[model samples]
Target: MAATASRSASPNTPGQQLFQALRRDTVGGALLLLAAAVALIWANSPASAEYFAIRDIELGYEPWHLRLSIGQWAADGLLAVFFFLVGIELKAEFTRGDLRRLRTAVVPIAAAAGGVLVPALICAAFLLTRPELLRGWAIPTATDIAFAVAVLAIVGSHLPKALRLFLLTLAAVDDLLAITIIAIFYTETIAVLPLAAALGVVIVYGLIASRFRRFFVDRAWAAWVVLLPLGLAAWALMHASGVHATIAGVLLGFTIPAVVGRASNRTTDADLGPSSQGGDGSGIDLAEALEHRIRPLSAGFAVPVFAFFAAGVDIGGSHGLAAAFTHPLTYGIMAALIVGKPVGILASTWLATRFTAGLDPSLRWADLTGVGLLAGIGFTVSLLVAELSFTAGSVEHDVAKVAVLSASLLSAAIAAFILTLRNAHHRRESQE
Candidate 1:
């Protein structure tokens, strides 16, 4: 992933550098999977009690109600870092990347909305008989960008760039939708004072970020030394606001400048790989630089660590693994992800292109089909939502985790098989 991203941002073309950066950061998906696997194994092993104990260990500033378990910290704290990176990607895409063009952006935007809405409705349909289970409707609505892109990088390397870009755009918008859902639906209570303080901090952070964009662009450590503290304050305040702290990451990320200032001069960093070619030194803007630096932190550490904390579901716990499979929520979540996601994305994209003026000439329905399958790989955020939906040690939560893991694995497998065939077809066509 690093090798792919670093190769060259110099090619002054608009989205090339952004795409490369995305590819590079997505490599961390392998590591994230490894962490989840380790957590699962460790939780189910003889050391299961130890694993649970470690995760439940609590420490934090208690007066502010900030004290939380290791697992809670991973969800509330580390995940913010991941969301921060998402914010950066979102801003860049909308302001400067392929999403800057209405025609280019409409298909993915519609597809993402459909992808989210259909899954929620599917889950609702299955759980309609049980009002208690309806809280988890959003569980399958998210697409784990890291896991999906990682699969694409491995299996669809030969596929067209447009397909890849479409996936990225859809996932980014899907995240925004998910964040909105979290803020609106999941938050049980709101503390206006803290929320207002968090917003104030965000505004200040944005202003400082805009004024010193060139400073942070030129010196990477400045972000760590200066921006990190403000980001933390914002996150802490947001947590106190009774809103999910991760939202703070997104707000902070949006504040960072996405494009280079006309007066600034900065070359693409050497870390962008040796293939870094085609830029007028100005193309290596602040957003790209932050992405280059923070992507590793989010993918390599923040996300994987969150996965480690969140994915430690004991299959043999009170509900038992067999019972989990039989649970209605399990079936609903699995159906929503494995079936609903692809169907939603494909149908929405097809309908939009047919009815509207948004279809890209270079894209085909077959390509969109493969992309839709990949969208089904919803692992990380799904698990987070599952956790939010039910109590920590309850049967429903445990069953939901099992469902998320099974569905994500199933989706990845199906996507791999479909994309493998599509890749071969594309290769053959190219040779002709």
Candidate 2:
């Protein structure tokens, strides 16, 4: 019985198990799915209006001398945390990941630039003709990393490891573009006093953190308690100052120490292979201490919370889907993420590698092209962009949500299909 059980054991493979766990657990992804399910059920239910009325419920606080609004406040306020984590990720990627140096960074950086610029152009070309939709230009410029990663992860053995990494790089680049546009173009008016106050607070935080060796000293924990409130104050200041509150996240994220993992053990050989006879220092240094402190917390809490709040959308199914795909704003977004991303990324990376970086001949153009298509799968940050594309409570805002959902899901599916087919073809050719 033991032998039979061992032979026929249906235990999930590690990757498969990880995939299932991630799918079930991602705070926003799970909630988005649940919310989507509820939306579908409600839309079909007799109480459809009741389901949508939830979108209108007053969740604001207007007590004492302060009279604050709710809907946009909740959406924007909650999403600021999302941007905060994004700020951390963008910095971490550039400081330590593939973008660490020129030699290792060519294909991904070029591809990312193409992915971002092409989508913006496509959105602009279509929407610029229509003044009403012009405000939503940033919608198409963003990509959702989870949906893209989820697509690749689901395809499993079909995708090459290199291709997966390529997609990740492109997604990172896509994020940078979306964040930049949000900070630079989408903001209202700059309120100076609050901006200055926010700057002052950031400086103070930096000083306190540096003086205390917050990254290394265990005693610094108590002082670190001040971070959230300070961050909140900064965000409020930014909000008051006319700059998008999201930029405050970027500013704060830079002050974070970049290293969390040891460079030596980052590889598989270090973890599973033999330990060295000699040691390299205490192994628990300041950089690792900082990363050890920040990464898990950021990954587990900050990121998922952001995803849940930012990703929720009311897809009306057939009608909703139709409106999302057909509307000018929707069409522009669809075209950019689907059509322009792959093409632009491929062209840019090829040009950079061939004429500039001079990559290895073995890294064929087809390989890069396949990877480029995979990068167009932008999900998380794109949804946030959709929220900003229109003023709160407007019909355009609702339409923008539908468009983000439709375009993200569609592009993710299409990119996966294309890449899987390409990978299959490449494997067959190699086998021959």
Candidate 3:
């Protein structure tokens, strides 16, 4: 969705756009959790063999290295759709939202860096002796934006705008870092010709998107008919190139024009409400339109399906559970998520605000502490990264998944507790 400028004269605020987006994400996040739970239960049940069989089913063309298991499809293909939404959101924020201003954006960006760095270091520390498990150091560095925001929507509705915006900005930057890590660190091998082909297709796609922006924006089905093939071709080429295919989604998302086609002055439908922006050729922008059309598929289907396929780690009965707990991978990820994340966020925020004089007096350190805890809820992205870090069906892979799930749950609980107390304090202060 298009984020309104913070300085806009319109009644619609950036907060409103974020709230609306988070509302949709909340529903998706709940569904994601439910799907994960089901997968976990099914994998551990009597019919666990069937679950593994379905996940291991391969159904792609053998040529071009496209033949992959069901789980691989969910991770490498469907998850790209989810990342596309992230790319759109990132572009929108930079182009139109609070992030448009460097002054407004620096705190969260710095905090996000700290959040990433500390967890990675903490994970490294725990896995120092176990070099094999160290690949998962990036697992806890991400924040599940949907799940964290959904928790805030439920528990921190009465809290100040500063806290909500802080969380949003931090999570957005966190996603960018995760994408960077996946693109840079995790890539194993590169096939030069296919990579070049993918880049060429993406460039052509960008030209087509920019040229036909108005046409595609006007005709909702045009993207599916024309753009989908181009996108699929790009994705296929990228997959062949041995880069994580999901990066293609981010690249494609960056190409979409943030504004509508040739609209000299665009007013969001959000700004004027339904009656004003619709019906006439001046309603929503192309970026917003794409978000609305694609988010349902991304959040509702892509994410949950990926979770269902990915989260079915067989933690190997009681013996496996005990071994996992003793494993460095498990301890590293848990420590990173539960401890390292908050410490990093808080320290970074403190340093930024201290040196820059940008702190809002009304917002206490406690408020940020709660937000930091929420940042620890690194579920969906963590699972994807874990799969990337270790071979599928390996012991390290299973332990890492279990660690991510456990750490996410623990982080969510801690965040809820902290924010609830903060919410009560804020309510009491307002009353007084």
Task: Give lDDT tens digits, candidate 1, residues 1-432.
Answer: 544443443545545444444446356778788999999999999999999999999999999888999999999999988889889888988887878878778889999999999999999998999999899999998899899898888888678888888998898789878888999999999999999999999999999887776677666678789898999999999999999898999999898877733332324344432321124543335677777767766776789999998999889955587798888999999999899988999889988787775677667777787788778877888898998999999989988998999999988888888889888988898899
The CA-based lDDT of model 2 is what? Answer: 0.59
Runs in model 1 with CA error above 4 Å? Answer: 1-26, 260-284, 317-319
Give all candidates' CA lDDT scores: 0.83, 0.59, 0.83
Candidate 2's TM-score: 0.74
Span of ten consecutive residues with least summed lDDT in model 3 = 268-277
Residues 1-432 of candidate 2 have per-residue lDDT tens digits of 434433333334674334324333243344444544455456446676764465455554444212333334544565565555555555666666656777667767777887788878888898887898888777777655544555566553544566666666677567767777887887767767878998887777556544544323333354357666777777777777767766776677666545434333221111111111113322222333333334334434444544444444455567866666677877787777778877888878878877667654445566565555555555556666776777654666766766666566666566666667766876776789
* Local error of candidate 3 at residue 159 (angstroms): 1.9
* Model 1 CA lDDT for position 116: 97
TM-score of each: 0.90, 0.74, 0.88
Candidate 2 residue pairs that clash: 28-308, 143-378, 143-379, 144-378, 144-379, 144-380, 145-379, 191-241, 260-291
Candidate 2, position 14, lDDT: 72
lDDT-best of 1 and 2: 1
Global Cα lDDT for candidate 1: 0.83
lDDT of 1 at 271: 43
Model 3's alpha-carbon lDDT is 0.83
Candidate 3 residue spans exceeding 4 A from truth: 1-23, 260-284, 360-362, 430-432
